[model samples]
Target: MDCLISVDGSVTVSLLKSIFFIINVLFYLNYILKNNIKKMNTEPLNLVNGKIMTLNESFPIVESLTIKNGQYYSLNNPHPNFKTINLNGAFVIPGFIDAHFHIKNLGQRLDMVDLKGTKSAEEIENLIYNKSKTLKSGEWIEGFGWDQNLWNDKNFPSSELLNKTIQNNPVYLTRIDGHSAWINNVAAKVSNFDLSTNIEGGSIVNDCILIDNAMDPIRNSMPKPNKDSTKKWLLSGAQYAAERGITNVHDAWQSPEIIESIIELVQENNFPIKCYGMIGGSFKDFLVDFFAKGQYSGKQYKLRSVKAFIDGALGSRGAALHEPYHDDHCNCGLILISKEEFDELASLCYDNNFQLCTHAIGDRGNSFVLDTYQKYLKAQNDRRWRIEHAQMLTTNDIGRLKECSIIASMQPSHCTSDMKWMKSRIGEHRLHRISRWKTLLDNGIVIAGGSDCPIEEGNPLHEFYAAITRTDHDGFPKGGWQSQEKLSRIEALNLFTKGAAIAEFSENNRGMIEVGYEADLSILSNDIMTIESEKILKTDVIATIVNGNIVYGNKNF
Candidate 1:
C-alpha cells in the first residue's frame, strides 16, 4: 500500500509539472497571436510634407507607425510587426527651436525675485521695501524685471529713492531689458564699490544705476546658489520651456560647470529639454576640454560654439553705431570688441571646428561682424558662424550677410518691444532699417528666432505675434509697424522651427514633421494658419512631443 501511494504521488507531481509547461507555452502563443492581430489592425503612414496632408483618397488611413532610424518602418516597409502611435485627425508641425536663448541666465534668474509689473518708481521701492522687511537687515535684496515704460512716468528710478525706501537692506533691481540695474547705496557698499569705481564695458549712472560693466561688482558680490538650488532652478526653467513648446534651445553663453551640471542631469535621465551650448571666449578652455573628450557627438547636449559680445544692446545706448545715437548725440555707442579681435576669434573657431556667434546690434557692429566672418570663412566653408541680434543693418551690410552666409539670430519680440523707442534712439532714417526682417528674407539670409529669455519671456506665440503683426503688446499701429516687413504665418513658423534648426546644425534631424525627421513636434489647440493675426496671441500650445515621447501637454486625450 505504501509503494502504491508513493507511485501515485510521483505521477501526480509529473502531471503537475507537465500542466505548468503547457500553460507557459499557451501564454507565449497567446502573446504572439495578440501582437499579430494588433499588427494587422494598425496601418503604417509615411509623412513627407510640413503637415500631415492627405493627397490620395484611396490610401489606407494610418492607425499606427514606427519611425525607425529616421525612416518610416511600417507594415508596407521591411520591419517586423510591432505596435506604434498614430496622431490621427490632428495637424502636425515641428517642435520649436529657440536658436538664441540665454538659458543659463534664465536658470539663474529663476531663483531671483521679479518686479515686472511695478507701476511707478514708488511701487518698485515698496516692493523691495516689503521684501527687505522680512529678511535680516544688511542682507542683499535682489529683484528683476522692472520696466520703466509700464510706470505712470516712463523713466528710470533713482537708486537714492531705493536706498531711502529699503534703508536696512542692500537692494539691486534690474530693469526689464536687463541692460540696466538700480543699486542702493548699501548694495554698492557691499559690492565693495562706491561712486568712484568704474569697470570696463559697463557704466555707473550718476544716481547709481549700473549699466553693463558696472554690474560686475554687484554680480560678483552675490554668492552663487548651492548645487541643489541651481538644479531646482534649472529644472523649473526647463519645465516652463517645455510647456511652451520649446523642445530645443541654443544657449548663448555657458560655463563648463553649468555644462557639467546639464550633463549630469542628462545622464540621470532628468533633463527633458535639448540644449546646444555656446561657451563664451572667457570659458573657451571648458569647451576645448569637452571636445577633447569626444563628448560633443551627442544629439542632446553640444558645446561646439563660442559667443562673443561686439557691442551692448540699443536700449542701453551702448550698441556700436556708424553714427551717434539720435537721442543722445554725445554717445556714438560703445564698441565692446574690435574687428581684429573678433576676426582672430573667428579664425580660432574655424580651426577648432567651433562656430562663432557674435552679438552685433547696430549697423556698425553688424558691419564689423560681417567683415570678420568674411575673413575667416574663406578658410573653412562649412562653419555656419552667426551674428547674434543682427538687429539694425545698413543695406550694404545686408548684402554682406548674404555673401558671408552668416545666420541672423534675431528675436522678433525685440522689434515690437523696441519700436516705441527705436526711432528716438537712431532717428527715423535708421529706424527704417532696424529689425529688417523683410530685406533679410528676400536676400536669402537665414533668420533664426529666439526670445532671449529672462530679458524677454520665452513665449513662441508672442514671438509669432510680434513677427507677423509687428505690433507692441497693446496692439499698436492700426495696420502695423513696417507692415511690409511682416512675415507670413508659414514664414514666421519656419523662423522659430526650421530656420532655428539650421542655425544649430540640426536641420537634418529636426524642424519638420516628415517621416525621417526626429519626432519633435508641437500641437496647437487651434489651427495657426487659419487664425486671425490678432488672435494668434490667444492661441495656446496643446501638447509638445520630443523624441517620440510626450513631454508636455495640457489636454487629457
Candidate 2:
C-alpha cells in the first residue's frame, strides 16, 4: 500500500509525495503561462466552451477551457486561431469519483446469475431452476443479489427448498449485502459442512444460509473468473461508469492477482477508468512485501491500502450490534474477529505506515474498531486510515471519528435502498442514530460519497440525487426520511469530488477544476445546479473526459 519505504530503490514515500506536489505546481505554472492567450504566443489544439462548474471557490464558473498536453490549461482565454467547439451551453462539472466501489466485484458479478430485483423466493428458485438445466454434475452454480428481507415472507430459506430446484449441481446464491449466502443441500455436502457445525463470526441459518466467514469456503470453491473474462467485464463496467460521468473508482477489497492485472492494464492503457485498489485480507501474508513497494501511481491505477472486515453487514442481520436486533430479538449479531486480532492487524498497518481500511457497520462494530484505533493512535498522526461504512454509530461515538481523523467512506445509495426497511430491522430509536450525513459533517468529520456497486447501482447521479434529497427511488417520505440531515447539492457534489479526493489524500491538485488539477471532468446535458431536486435524476451525461481525453460520449467537444 502507500507506505513509507520502497523495495525497488531509495525512492521513499515522502520523496514521491514531494515529486507529485512539484509536478502539480509545475503543471499549474505551465497552464497559467499557456493560458495567457491575450499575448497570443503559443497555439492551442482544442478549446471547449460550456457552463463549467469548477467547484473551486476562487473561480466558480468559466466560459471556455483551453487544452494543452491533454490538460485544462486555462479558462476563458482561448486562442482566436484554434478551433473552439461550443456545446450550446451544456453544463460541465468535475468528473465524479465513487469513494467506496469494488471494481473486482462489479466485474465478477457481470458474469454471474443476477438476482437483483427478484420479488420473492419463488422467483429466485425459478431463476436458478432455468440455469440448473445447463450445469453438469458437481459443477457449482453461483448467483448474487438475493435478499430474504425483500421477499414476501421476509424469512430465511431452507436447504431442502434450494435442493428442490437446483438438483443437478451445487447451487450457492449470495445475499445482496454480500455478507451472507444461501445454499442447497448438495452445496452443503460439497462445502464439507454439517448444519450443526459452529463458526465464529458466521452462521448457517435454517440449515441452508451461510453468513459472513461461513460463506467464504463455499465461495472459494467456485472457479474464479478468468483474466480475459475479468477484463471483458471490467471494460463493460468501465464503459457504464464513464457513460454516467465517473472518472475514478475505488476498487475495494481487491486480490493480488487482480491488482497485478490492473497494473498491466494501466501500463497497456487497457483499463477504462482510474482505479484505486484496497488489497484484500486474504493477502495478509504479502503485506510486508506489498508495503515495502509503497504506492503504485500510474495513469490508470494506484494501490495504496489494505482492506479488512470487522463484522457482517446489517442487511443479513449479521452486523455486530451492542444490543439484540429488533426483528430477531434473540440474536445480537456476529463479531467477525476478536479485539486482540483487530489490534494486532491495526498495529501491523500502523507500524508499516500502511493505511488500514476496515469495514465496520453496526454500533458495537464501530465502537470496537474505534477503541482499537484509539489504542494504537495515542497521538494523532497523518495516517489517513479509514472506516469503510461507519454506517451505524451511537451519539457518543460521533466525536471519536473527528478525534481520530478517520474518513467516512460511505455509499449514498445504501440509504435509499435500506430506508424502506431500516426501522423494521433496527427499531425506531436506533433509526434516529444512523447514517447522519449532516451530523457527521457538522461534527468536523470528513465524508466521502459512493455507490457500493453490485450491491447498489453505481450511478453517480443516482447517488447525488439520494445524498441531497435523502429519499428513495419513489421519492418517499416527501420531506425525506430525515430532512434535517440532508446535504445540499454542492455538498453532495463535493462528497464525490473534493471530499473523495481528501479521503484518498490527493486534495492538493485533484477534485477541483483548477490549473493544476487533473483535467478529469464530466459534462452534462442539463444544468443540475439550478434544476429542481426531483429533476436532478433526469440530467444526462453529454460527455465524460478523463485526463482531458474524451473517453465516453459522441459530443466530440
Candidate 3:
C-alpha cells in the first residue's frame, strides 16, 4: 500500500512540472511575437504641417515631405499610417537672406528710446527732455533714429539746443541713417575733443554735431552693453527676424570679441539666428590671431569676411562723389582711407583667403573701390570681393564692376528714400543714374539686395516691395521712381534669395528649395506670387524653419 501511494504522488508531480514548462514556453513565445509585431508596425518620428509646400514651383498635387536631420525627402505615395498636420495650402519658399545687417547693434537698441517718427527738431527735443527727467543725474542719455530730412529745418540739431533737454547727463543721439550724431559737450570733453579735433574724412560742425568718422571717438567712449544685455539683444533680434521669416543674416561687421561671445551663447543654446559675421575692419588683428589659432568651417557662426568702409553715406554729405555735391560746393565728399592703406588691406585679405565687402556709396568712392578690386584680382586671380551699398555709380565706374567680377551689394529702399533728396544733393543728371540695378544686371553684374538694418530696419518685405514697385510705401507717382529700373518679381526674389547666398559663397547649401539642400524655408500666409504688388508689404509670415527645426511660427493654426 505504501509503494502504490508513493508512485502515484511522484507521477502527479511529474505531470504538473511538464504541463507548467509547456505553458511557460507558450506564454514567452506569445509575448515575443506581440513585441515583434508592434516594432514592425511602428512609424518613424517624422512629420510636419503642410498641405503641399510649394518650393517656388507648381505642385501637381498635395504631398507630405519628410525632413530628417536637416535634409528633405518626399514621402512614398499613399504613404504610412503615421500622424500628420495640414498646412491648408499655404505657400512655402526659401527663407529670406539678409545680406547686410547689424545684428548686435540692432539687438542692443531694442530698449533705447526710438525717435524715428519725430517730425521736427522740437518734437525730438521734447521727447528727450521727458525721458531724461526719470534717469539719475549724470547717467548718459542715449537715443537713436532722428532724421534731419523729416524735420522742418532739414538740418542737424545743434548740441546747444540738445543740451537744454538732457543738460545734466552726457547725451548722445544717432541720426536715422547712422552716418551722423548729436553729442553733448560733456561727451566731447570725455573723448578729449573740443572744436579742434581733426577727424579724417569726417566733420564736427560748429554746433558740435559730428558726422561720419568724427562720431567714432565719442561712440567708442560710450559704455558697451554688458554680456547679459548683449545676449538679450542678440536673442531679441533673432526672434524678431525669425518671426518675420528671415532665417539667415549676413552680419556686416562684428568684432572678434563679440563673435566669441556670440559663439559661447550659441553653444549654450541661447542664440536665435543663423549668423555669418564679417569681421569689422578695426578687428582684423583679432581675426588674424584667432584664425592662426584655428581655421573654422563656419558651421556655427561664420567668420570669413572682412568689412572695410571706403566712404560715408550720401545723406551726411560725406559720400565720396566724383563731383562736389550740387548743394554743398565745398565738398566732393570724403575719401575715408588712403589708397596705400587700401592696397595693404587688400593684400592682407588675399593672403588670408578672407573675402572683402567695402562700403562705397559715393561715385568717387565706388570708382576707387572698383579700381582697388581690379588691382587686387589681377594680383591674386580671385574675384569674390563685394562693394557694399553701390548706391551711386558713374557710368565709367559701372563697367569696371563687371570686369572685376565684384558683386554690387545694394539696398532698394535707399534708392526710394533718397530719391526725394538725392537729386538735390547730386543734381538731377548725376542722380538719374542712381541704383541702376537693371543697368548692372544688363552689364552682367551680380546685384545682391539687403536692408542694411539699423541704417534701414532689416525688413525683406520692404526691400522686395521697394525692388518691384520702386515707389514709396503709399504707391506714389502712379508709376514709380525710375520705374524702368524696377526688378520683376522673380528677379527681386533671386536677389534676396539666391544672389545673397552667392554673395556669401554658400549658394550650394542654401538659398533655394530642393532635395539635398539645408531645410531652411519660410511659409507665407498669403500667396506672394498672386498677391497684388501694392499689398505685398502686408503679407505675413506663417512659419520660419531652420535646419529642420521650427524656430518660429504664428502657432494659431
Give residue 234's error in model 3 in angstroms: 1.3
TM-scores of all models? 0.84, 0.90, 0.87
lDDT of 3 by residue, 238-306 (tens): 888888888888888876446656665666666655787787876544555644443344444666788
Lowest lDDT 10-residue stretch of candidate 2: 36-45
Relative to the unseen true structure, what is the Cα RMSD of model 3?
Answer: 19.1
Residues 1-557, candidate 1, lDDT per residue (tens digit)? 24333544554565465445444433433343344311111133333212331111242233333555433343223234443433444455568888878776677677667786778888777777778878998888888888776666666676668766777778877777767788888887777787676566666776678876677688779776765765666677778888888888888887555655665566556777788888777654444453444325354566678888877778877788999998788877667765666677777777777888998888888887887788766532557889988998899988878877888998999888878777778897776777788789999988999988878889988998898889976789767787888888878888988899888888777776555566666666556767777777777777776665567877632
The deviation in Å at residue 45 for candidate 1 is: 12
Candidate 1 yields a Cα-based lDDT of 0.72
**lDDT (tens digit, per residue) of candidate 2 on 1-557:** 45656877455866676456444433432343344312112234354557989988988998778766556677778867665667678898888999888777776787778999888888888888888877778888889998877888888876667777777688888899999998888887776777678888888888888899898778776677777766666677777788889999887887655765565455456665777778776565455555655555554566677888888988898888998999989988888988877887888788877788889889998888898988766546678888888888887888888888888888877877888888989898898677788899988778888888878889999999888888886788798886777888888888999988887777876788887567788888878878988788888888887776678885444
- Stretches > 4 Å off in candidate 3: 1-64, 75-83, 291-295, 378-382
Per-prediction backbone clash count: 2, 0, 0
After TM-score superposition, what is the CA distance of residue 197 in candidate 2 from its true location, in Å? 1.7
Q: Sorted by lDDT, highest first, which candidate order results?
A: 2, 3, 1
Which of the two, 2 or 3, has more lDDT? Answer: 2
What lDDT is reached at residue 274 by model 2?
79
Give the Å error, residue 518, model 1. Answer: 1.1
Local distance difference test, each candidate: 0.72, 0.78, 0.75
